[model samples]
Each structure stands twice: as C-alpha cells, then as structure tokens.
Target: MLSHLEFSGFYFIKNLHFGELGFVQSAQGFIFLSGLLVGLIFMKRHERAGAAQVRRRLWGRALELYGWHIGILLAILALSRLMPDSWFVWNRWLGRLYDGGDVYVAAAAALLYQPSYMDILPQYMAYLLVSPLLIQLIATGRAAWVMAGSAACWLAVQLGAHMPLVALLDGLWMGGATLQPRAAFNPLAWQVIFVSGLVAGALAARGELQPRRLLDPQRPMLFHLAVGGLVFFLAWRMAITTGLIAPEVLERFQAYENRVEFGLVFLLNFVALGYAVAWLLVAGQRSASYGLRVGATLLNRLLSHPFLVLIGGYSLQVFAWHVVAVYLLRLVDWHVGPLAEPLNSLLAVAAIASLALPARWLASRAPTRLADAPQPSRS
Candidate 1:
C-alpha cells in the first residue's frame, strides 16, 4: 500500500511539485520493502538451496535489473529523439546526458552514469550485486558490523564521498567522465535503510521479528521518538520557510536532495510512518466488521482489488512505464497544453491498471529455460 501511495505520490510531486515533507518520500519505503522482501525470500532460498546458491541467485536478480535499467534508458534516449522540436521538453536536455563519441560508452555503462530520476534502479542493482556479502554478514551473526559498515558508508558519502564505480569507468569514455550521477541518491547512504529492512525481513522469515517492535503503544520511548521526529521535521520546514538558514550543509541538502536522503529525519519518519501504517494494515487485515460505516473488510478489499494488486505485484514494469509516461506527459504539456493535466491524471490511473498486461505479455515472450529466482517486489 505504501508502495502504491509512493508511486501515486510521484505523479503528484512531479506535476504539482510539492510533496517533500520529512516522512513523505514513498521511495524510501518502497526500496526498503524491496530489500525486506529480498531478505525474506533469500533466507527461504538459502534454506532450500545453500549460501552459495543464494549468492548466485541474488546476482542473477541484479543482472535482470541491469537489463531492465538499460532497456528503460534506451527507451528514454529514443523518446528524447522522437520528441524534440515536435512536442515535448525532454528533448531540450536528453542529448546532454552523453557526448557524441561517448554515446556507446554511456549507454553501455548506464549503470554508472544514470540521468536524473533514474538513480533508484541502478542503486537497487548495486545493492543486489553486493547483497550476498551483506546476507553473509547477517547469517554469520555479525549484524553489528553490518550496521557499523552501512552507517560508515552512508556517513562518508553524506560527508561528500562518491562511489568509485564511475571513477573506474572514466578510463574508457572519451572526453571528461564524471562518474557520479546527474542527481545522486547516494546508494551508500541508503544501504542502511535497505539493510535494516533486509534484517527485519530475515528475522521475520526466521520467526524472530515481533509485532511488538512497533505495536506497543505503551512504549514511551517510541512515542517520544515519533513526537521528537515530527517536531524537528516540521520545525526545520518552518525555519527554512521563515528564512532561518540551516546550521549545516547536510541539513540543507536533505531539504532538497534529488530523492529522499536516508539520513536521520528519514529514519525517524520511516519508523513513525511505518508504525502508523502497519497498525492500520493489521487492523484492516481482520475480516470482522467494526463499528465504522465503511468497514475494514471493505477497505482491505479495495486495497486488494486487481488494479492495486497488479500494480504492486508488477511494480518494476509500472515504474519503467511511469518514467516514459512522465516524459510523454511533459511533451503533451509543451505542445498540447490544455490536455496535459487531464491526460496526466488519466495516465496515472491507466498506468496502474494497464501496465501489467504488457509486462505479462513480454514475460510470456521471454526465454523460459533461464533460471532466475522469484522477483522480490518493492511493495
């Protein structure tokens, strides 16, 4: 449900341009859920197979993501060309992504140098590539080291460090090769969120995680944490709006990070928002009707309707379609101005309900003999 909301929110944020509250970035939850699911699934796979097989399976998943990432970029590049003086505004800067001579290199190395709004997929690929090591660390009972290492990487990047993958690729590309993305989501920084979710999922798979982790309303510490987080976030927003400069660069950067920065405020809101959502979901999961006019059963049914279920199930396909749709919508706004708003809204709904069919069709056409483990959906 959060994933669906986050995907929906992207449309609102991009079109209306204002959903950057402390706890509102849905991608954080989405990615975390992806990690969580992977953790759960990987544990199951490991039990059925072995640690080495789990490693191979994860790398295979990364390779699958790699293919999808490349496919989307290729589509975007083609669309960028197809839209130019004709209609959309995407043509204005799409060519800027690569040098003429470096086009092949850039396309080939898309994982290293993604365009703006395309950072998240590559980050997933990067994390998945190294997930075996992470899972091993946990499987071996070195979770503290996992936390320490993840936090260290995040803090280092937060303190101005960049990933070295781009730097390594610089040797091949002609002209200057700045390895960092156009807009950096800082995967190193985000590992903590994903890994934490991964740990939670793994624990749950092992029957170790408990609902009481968040369900205990009597826990004053948790209440204080939520209150303090919300207060600080709201206060920070007020301060910036009122023209009080932030005390530090990081604090200011979090205000306008291209996507959600997995920092303190994000963690706080994640926990608080997660608690609230989980509580609602648990309450709603019950089939028994409460006193409400629109009971939990109906709400749950709405949540599980074909459209929402399929969208959440085939989220990656929906996401790729979303990128293309957003760009095309921008084009419509450029030329067919009056139709843009209504068209965008229509696209959002159609995107959720219709994308899965094409995705299913494509999957049916795909080679069947290849052995890739089940996809761990973000939702």
Candidate 2:
C-alpha cells in the first residue's frame, strides 16, 4: 500500500484530500520503525563484537556509502550527458532543489534532487560516521547530558555556526529551513535522533524492554477502546492548548518528528508516534484477525524483500526511471490524457515487481565459497 501510495504521488494525506491522518501516521510509523530496527541491528552486532569491532565495521560501511553516493552523482552526470536531448531535464529540477524554488514542485520531486530517500542514504551515513562518538556518550550512562549536548550543538547550527567538517562530508544541505531548536537533517539537529537510536539500541541490547504481555486477549474490547480514546483526546487537547496545531505539526506528531530537519515539536511527535506504532504492532500481532495476518504478511514481505516484492530490491532503478519519465513529459510540455498519471503509476509499480524477481533470483543463488562450510564431526 505504501509503495503504491508513494509511486502514485500521495506522499502527504492532504494531497489525496483526505482529512484522515492515516497517511502521515503510517509514514512516521515507518520512519521510526526504521530507526528502531537500525538501532537493534547495530546494537546487537556491537554487543557480539564489542564496540571496537562494531565501530570498525560501521566505518567501512560508511565509507562504502560515501563511495556509493559519489557513484550516484557520477551516474546522474553520465545519464545527463548521454541523453542530452532525452525526455527529461535535470538542470531545471536541480536548480529548484538548491533553493526550493520550482513551479512544478509536485511533479519533479525526485528529479528536483531534494534530500529524499536517495539523499537520506548520505544522512544515515553521517549518523554512522558519528556512531562511535554517540555510542560512547550514551554508554556513559548520562543520556540526559547527551541529549542536552546534542540540543546545544543543534542550537549552534541554528545560529548559523556551520560545522565545516560535517559540511565537507555530508554536503551543504541542511534540513528544512529554520535552524532554531536545530531540527531537520543538519547533522547538528539529527544527532539527537541518532543518539536516541543509540540509547534505544542499548536498552534493547540489555533486554530491558518489556514484552507485550499486558494486552491479553481476555482484556475487554471496551478497555482497549477507552485507552485509545484517551490517547487521542490527550494528543488533540495538548495540540490545541499549545496553539501549535498546524498540519505540519500534526503530521510530525503522527510520524515521529524524524522528518528531514523538521521542527522540534514534530520531532517529539516522531517519538510519540514511534511508541504508538510499536504498541500497535505488538498488540496487533497478538490480537488481530486473519485479515490482518494476511495484510501484514504482504506488507512485511514487501518491506523485507523490497527488491523482490516491489520491483528489484534497489529503489535506485525505480527512481532513475521516474527521472527519465519526468524528463520526457517536460520535453514535450505535454499534459495530454489520463494516460499520463495512470500509466506512470503502473510503470513504477511494474518496475518494482519486475525488479523484485531478479533480485530474488540473485539472492537465491549464493556463491559456492560462501555456501561451503566445514561440518563438525559428531563424537
């Protein structure tokens, strides 16, 4: 559903004219879940290998990501040169991305070169680069101090005190404008989330998180309903009382504020929403019906095997296709039939499905050396 929604260009719920908060909620849930999973994976690895080993591995991955990013830039440059008169126009879109100044902002979103998923790879690399420092800070058992320190750094950036080192590595783009409270993708702002992930990872590694045993099946439906109502009311009332109830604010809260340098309030929302989603998934796994099971299986499969489930596990190919399509559309400046939107959507989906097949096939076939392992003889 999310894959379809994304390709269909329904990023924001409001874009679909839906007053319901489901879309934003789902997106936030996904992002927060991603962070949690990242933390869990790394923390577990860290525990097994010790911080030194984990840090070394992560550093290698970070370097690989940097190389990959440069490769992406090269590919974009090559494609542009090769197809000089092709259907797409990269220059205009890139210009818009530089300043958020574009007339067709909606159409050429990916093409415009904003800090989206592709760009987010580098953002994640930034966090990985600083992983050891963040891990050490959190390990000191002074999470509060770390948060405060992160906040201070963010404030410095907001004050336009640029960190040249990070800029040299991650490039000049910071999160959405407004530096105060240091929200957004700027390393200064994002340290909070990265640290938070580290803390969460540490907690998870210690097996400190309580399992979802409280939501037993014996619990009455009314009890669950009442609790849900209470949460909703509290969220709504708090928003109203604070007078920061804008769509962006609501969206952030719904998603878990890990937005691309989104605001502080939004960031808080990100945390809240993360907990909410975690709770929901826990409860749902235990209490939901067969339909939910089927739906979840599909969703999990797609997320787990994105390349196989959607197209090919690589979203880059899909993205590159979109860029080419946009270029074509712009070349003729043609907005002619219904076919444009529908066909584009179908093609994207098809790309995802087709790519998934090859990816799955490749994954299934392991190299003989990797598959070979010495067996221990039984006494």
Candidate 3:
C-alpha cells in the first residue's frame, strides 16, 4: 500500500521517503512475501487435501483476482464515460481505452491490457495460476529444478526473450491503436523473486530450512556481511537521491537498476535487507544486548499494530481499493491542479486511512467471506 501511495505522488512523510531509500521498491517485497505466504499456507494444504484440491484453491484465487481486475476496469470505464471528455484527454491511460474502442476493452478483460496501477494484479494472477505446478514440483522433491526454471525465465527476460511474446500479443490484439506494451511489471523476470520465496517457504514448511537456525545470532558472519551490504546500498541510494553523486553517474546507476527487470542491484539489495531484518528480529528475542532487544521490540510492535495487520489481512481487497484510490486521486489532481504541502500530506493520510474501510468491511463479513479469511501462516 505504501507502494501505491508512492506511485501516486503522495509523500505524506517527507523525511522517511521509503520509495527513495533503496534500489528495491515495496512491490518486490510485496510479490515475494505474497509468494512466501502462498507457499507456506498452501503447501500444508496440499499435504492434507492433495494436489487436486490445491490446484482448485490456487486457481480459485486467480479467479478472485480476475474479478477484482475486471471490476476495477469496469468502474474506471464507467467513470470515464460519466466524466467530461477533457478528463480522459488529461489522462492518457483512460483516453486509450476509448480510443481503441471495444477491442481494447476485450483485451483488458482478457488480461492482455493493463493500465498504470492496474498491472500488478495481472502478474499476480499469472503467478497464482502457475503456483500449483511449482508447488507440486517442490513437494515432489524437484525444488532445485523449479528454482532453476524460474531463474532461467528471469535470465531469458533479462536477455529480452519476453519482449517478442509481448509484442506478438500486442500486434495480434491491439491493432494500430497504440504500440506500447500493456504490462508494467514483467512477470517472467519478477518470478525469480516469487519462486525464491516460494521455495524458501516450502522448505521451511517441510523443516528443511529452519528460520531460527538461518537467522541465529551466533552465526554473525553472514549477518555482518548483510549489514555491510545494507549500509553500502543505503549510502549509494542517499548519494543518488541527495545529488551527492553526479548526474551522469546517477543516470548510469538508474539504467542498471531497472525495476521491471528486477535488476541485479535490486536483487542484491533486497537480499541484504532481508537478511539484516531477519537477524534483527531473531536477535531481538535471543540477543544479550538490551538496547538491540528493546529497539527490535518497538519496531516489531509498530509493524504488528492492529491497523497494519487489518490492512494486511485483507490484502487483496485493500490492494484493489488502493489502485482505485490512486486513480481517483489522479483524477482529482487533474481537476484541482497539484495539491501543495500539508494538503497533499493530509490527502495521502486520508487515502491510506481509507484503506481501512474495505478491511473493516471484510472483517465484518469474515464469517462468510472465506476468500478474505486469514491464511494459515503469514509472516
């Protein structure tokens, strides 16, 4: 959700600009964690219910995501129709839908056309659709092969193998309306992160990987290395963002840190940060140092706050609502012009706070809302 806020140009807290802090973004963590939770939860389900049941459940989730995607698109289309022509003219993303006519709508419904802030769901749907197979491979002791295949896909994407397929689909379906690719997040490249988390979660589920042992404070070598890497990346990020680095150098760095491709720098930074965090969390409970323990406790409490947990528990609903909020906020910006200072901050706060509405609604209907129920295991 912080990611959607960042994308929407809402920096409610200027000092803590999370989006600018690293080579990686929240989307990577979101996708990775989603895959992790799926692996952790569904693998156990697979064991109890068998592969057929697991496939049914995962595909059902994809269907749910599909409903949200189509529903949001329909809502946006309705708004475009009801709003003034100038509104669509101001928003090229919305304008393209009308410009391309029913063909574009069909493409969107078919998940081939995704507008800004609306692409992630399609990628997630793709992941969920294939997760059963990947999980099955892992369950059947071919986890290494699954990882290798995922890495190969990512490598192929890095080598530009995915573009031809995207181009083919666009040419076949979009006609001459526009020449741009539909997806912002390339699932082929991003699957490496997801599959990594999935494999980790599956291993942890089967007791092949123990979190405590992996993060044990006694083994300080890897943790120290992780800290060093985190510091280096953080310093580099600060240098670029603060203009401490020259513009030419920054441009080159940016070129290499492609988010769509899940560039090498991002993958490295994410790994470093992940290890550092895990170590900190583990040390919080097991460390001899009182200060470290206290600090970690506070951080954990802040993260595990009821409101945040509420938003997390109903992640899909909150995510869909966030996309809608971003679009609605963009529409407001187009009409009212850019909001300044505290107003923008307040708007950001309001928008983030509004996510609770859907969460609360889902919570209220929890007894019957099996789709929105909390997963068996989430970390």
Which residue pairs overlap in candidate 3's backbone? none
Return the lDDT, model 1, position 350: 60
- How high is each candidate's TM-score? 0.74, 0.60, 0.89
Q: What's each prediction's clash count? A: 1, 21, 0
Which should have the higher lDDT, number 1 or number 3? Answer: 3
Q: For model 1, which pairs clash?
A: 88-331
Give the CA lDDT, 0 to 100, for residue 5 in model 3. Answer: 48
RMSD of each: 7.1, 8.6, 4.9
lDDT of 3 at 16: 59
Model 3 stretches with alpha carbons more than 4 Å out: 1-15, 174-178, 367-379
lDDT to native, each model: 0.63, 0.49, 0.80
- Top lDDT hit: 3
What is candidate 1's CA lDDT for residue 155?
74
Q: Higher-lDDT candidate among 2 and 3?
A: 3
Q: After superposition, how far is residue 173 of candidate 3 from its true place, in Å?
A: 1.7
Writing each residue's lDDT as its tens digit, candidate 2 over 160-227 gives: 56655544423323333422211124555655666665666665665764445433434435334644
Per-residue lDDT of candidate 3, residues 1-379 (tens digit): 4455432344556445565677767787888998999889988988898999999999998999899889988887777678665355336565467677788778788877677778888989999999999889999999999999998998897788887787787677757445465667788888898999999998888778888888776676787898799888889988876779988888888776888788778888998888777788776566666876786788788889999999999988898788778777767766775666777777777887999999999788877878667779875
